[model samples]
Target: MKRLRSKYTKGEEVKFISHLDLLRVIQRALRRADIKVAFSQGFNPHPRISFGPALMVGATTEGDYMDVDVEEDISPHEFKERMNEVLPSGIKIVEVFEVDVRDSLSSRIKGADYLVEVFLKKEVEGLEEAVKRFMAKDTIEIEKETKKGKKLVDLKSYLEEFYLIDMNGERAKFYVKMKLGEGSPNPFHLLKAFNEYIGDAFDLEYYKIHRKNMFLE
Candidate 1:
């Protein structure tokens, strides 16, 4: 058996699709491509496939990854080409490589990078100062809902990096690295803190967010 790793992209056109639907789409595409994918041995056998971190719905991503155990070895180039031919327009295979099954992408992922563009309802000033104030605090606590209940967390702890990339009169661009794994903070939580800090004027739903990179460590 050969373990293959493939990088795929989710464009804005399909950002609204839930993560489960995206997985289903790829599984169907794999079947249509006629690849000899391996399956688990059980009564209700499923594809021997694994995925990296799940991207939030309504957020586009370019660095998504998947691992599949296939029955036969296929060249990386041909594997990518075959999958792309079957995948939907918004999802495309970017690259494929042979991988050691032991070093799984999901297991190794440490964090992810995001670029968020907030289009202000109107030209708002002092956005840069707000970011600076957020960064300057000793402890930035924000409320987050967990499986048990809602809890307050220190936002500064889970943030690996933050930068104000650009700010035009009408839009503000922020690049942030959010931690993953157990006890890691969700980017959405940080955004909530930002919205609260900026007051109710800037709604986060109007933001254009994209996952630009994934960090494996």
Candidate 2:
């Protein structure tokens, strides 16, 4: 048996589906496609299936991925066509690649790239200044609370790369590459950091954030 990594897109409405539900749907489709999966020896005996990092609800994605094991070698083309035919609408098989059995999809992820579109509430306040300032900070610290408790970390340090492009008028789209921040920071958290740095004039609700790319380090 070999492991296969598949990338998929959660189009429009399907973005509302949670990760667990998506797994159920994929498992059902795998059964319909007659693919063999390794199973656990435990009482539950679930198939050996692993997924990449979860995509948040309400966010459309083109880079969400999962890893599954098969009892026999299957070409990426055949597997992709078969699975795509059976997968529900809004969920699709984009690419299927053979991966080392020992490698983990989760651990391979080093960072994710995002394209955030921010629309000004009014005729623009100081967004350009805010973005420039936020992007230029030597260190931008924010409070992040986890089960281990809250800790302050530098936002700039976690940021690997970023770019700001003004769309039209007061609208701007930011292509930001963060080091996965390691501690599970979200787009809202990032916006919060910018607001904190530039002083509370930034409004998150006025903007729409899209995750353009996800990467493995």
Candidate 3:
């Protein structure tokens, strides 16, 4: 068996697919490409493929990683070519390489960087100042509903970096870096918290969020 790691992109066309649907799409593409992916041992065997942290539905990604185990030795170049030939539009394999079978993508990913563009009804004054004050606070708490019950979580604790990159009339852009994995705050929720913090300064019309990259340990 050979383990391969790949970096790929999720474009606008597939941004709305759920993580489970995305997995099915990849598995189907592998089958159409005639790649012999290894299956887990059991009565109900499943493909031995795994992905890094799941991307939120409606968010596009520039660089996402996945690891797959194949039954045959296939060169990374050939694998990439085959997969691309069958993958639907908006999903493209960017790079591939061999990796130690034991290494897992999920465990190595530390955080993710995102580019967010918000469309507002109108520009509000002191927007930058509000962001500064929000970030300067010792704690920013938001209510999160978990399986057990609702709990207050410190949004500031999960954020490594965040700042406004640009702001024009009715439009604003931000760059955010936040922890990934269990208990990590969602970017959308973070934005909601920010909006509230500034006394609802953002009369948000809509927003576009794109994941720029993942940081690995």
Q: Candidate 2: minimum summed lDDT over ten consecutive residues — where?
A: 119-128
Query: 1-217, model 2: which lDDT tens digit per residue?
Result: 7888898888876877898999999999999998887776877888888876676676677786788888877888888988999998998989999988898888887777777776654455666666776688788778888789998877777787666676566666777777663476666678777756555545666666666667875
lDDT tens string, model 3, 1-217?
9999999999999999999999999999999999999999989999999999889899999988999999997999999999999999999999999988988888899999999888766567877777788889999999988788898999998888889898988788998999998767778878889888766656554788899888877
TM-score of 2: 0.85
Model 2 lDDT, residue 71, Cα: 86
In order of TM-score, best first, we have 3, 1, 2
Residue ranges of candidate 2 with Cα displaced over 4 Å = 145-151, 167-170
The 10-residue segment with the lowest total lDDT in model 1: 196-205
Please tell me which predicted candidate would have the highest lDDT against the true structure: 3
Model 1 lDDT tens row, 49-145: 8888788788898987888888876888888998999999899888898988676777778888999887666565677787888888888898777
The lDDT values for all models are 0.82, 0.76, 0.89
Clashing pairs counted in every model: 0, 0, 0
- Give the top-scoring candidate (TM-score): 3
Error of 3 at 210 (Å): 0.2
